[model samples]
Target: MTAIVARPVSVKLDQETRGRIDRLATSRRRTTHWLMREAIQQYIEREEKLEAYRQNGIAAWEAYQASGLHVTQEEADAWLAKLEAGEDVEPPACHV
Candidate 1:
């Protein structure tokens, strides 16, 4: 058995949506609050992914600048073109 913490929240729904929620809850033997919590959890997970991507982009740009390598838009395009052409460019050697 697992212990769960629950909170009380107030939400307003129109008559039609309220009726639908009641029917679904009755059919599935679930409370509307459980469904809402699951929906919110999924939304939070997606937003977290976007936040991670933003952080990774910022980190990569800062690393590039710290490396003292001058990178231009033309060089970026050329690298992309090489990548698109399936050229085997060796990975940058890292100094530990």
Candidate 2:
């Protein structure tokens, strides 16, 4: 098995936040360090997902501008409504 390398860092929390973290860690029978590490890991994952979504939107916009292919609002709304109603519906065809 491969060994994991760890680095140590310091953070300063406000009094109220520190108190909350301490209380929560105690309740969960975990160390404050574990709680903080878990919180930072979750935060990084969420931010990375958001960044990927933003990049995908930018790419889609550029593609649409270049190809001039898209569906009308009405068609998109119809497709979305069908999806919301639990119907298996294909998306509207993109057109100029």
Candidate 3:
């Protein structure tokens, strides 16, 4: 495993938000710095997942435009029904 080297970054917050975080940190028995770090880390992770999903969607759209291959909504519904019924079936084949 690799070690993590941290650096300092400064952010300016208004007094109301700063006081809220301080009060919540005090209630949670954690330092304000730790709360900020955890919040930033979680926000980054969630946004990264959203970004990857967006990219995948763009790629799929491009591929569909190139090949014109797709399955109908009825076929998709049937596959979903099977899965909902606990059947381990393969997905429907795509067609032009």
Candidate 4:
């Protein structure tokens, strides 16, 4: 295991927003800093997943444009349904 080095960061907020965060933090018995850090962590994770999905879509599009090979919607649905029923099965083969 490795130790993590913590660094200080500064963020500016409006008076009303600061007050709102302070009230929530007091009620939850947590520091405003903790809430802000958690919110940032979650936002980053979600955005990373979205970016990966976008890249995968771009790759799949390029592959289809090059090879003109794919499975039909019905074939894909059937293969997915088999898996949903807890059966171990391979995916449908791609075709031109």
Highest-lDDT candidate: 3
RMSD of each: 5.0, 1.5, 1.6, 2.3
TM-score to true structure, per model: 0.52, 0.88, 0.93, 0.80
TM-score of 4: 0.80
Question: All models: lDDT?
Answer: 0.80, 0.98, 0.99, 0.96
Q: Give stretches of model 3 more than 4 Å off.
A: 1-4
Order of all candidates by lDDT, from best down to worst?
3, 2, 4, 1
Clashing pairs in 3: none
Model 1 residue 45 CA deviation in Å = 1.0
Clashing pairs in 1: none
For candidate 4, lDDT tens digit of each residue in 3-47? Answer: 999999999999999999999989999999998898899999999
Best by TM-score: 3
Backbone clash count for every predicted candidate, in the order shown: 0, 0, 0, 0
Error of 1 at 88 (Å): 9.9
1-96, model 2: which lDDT tens digit per residue?
999999899898899999999999999999999999999999999999999999999999999999999999999999999999999999999999
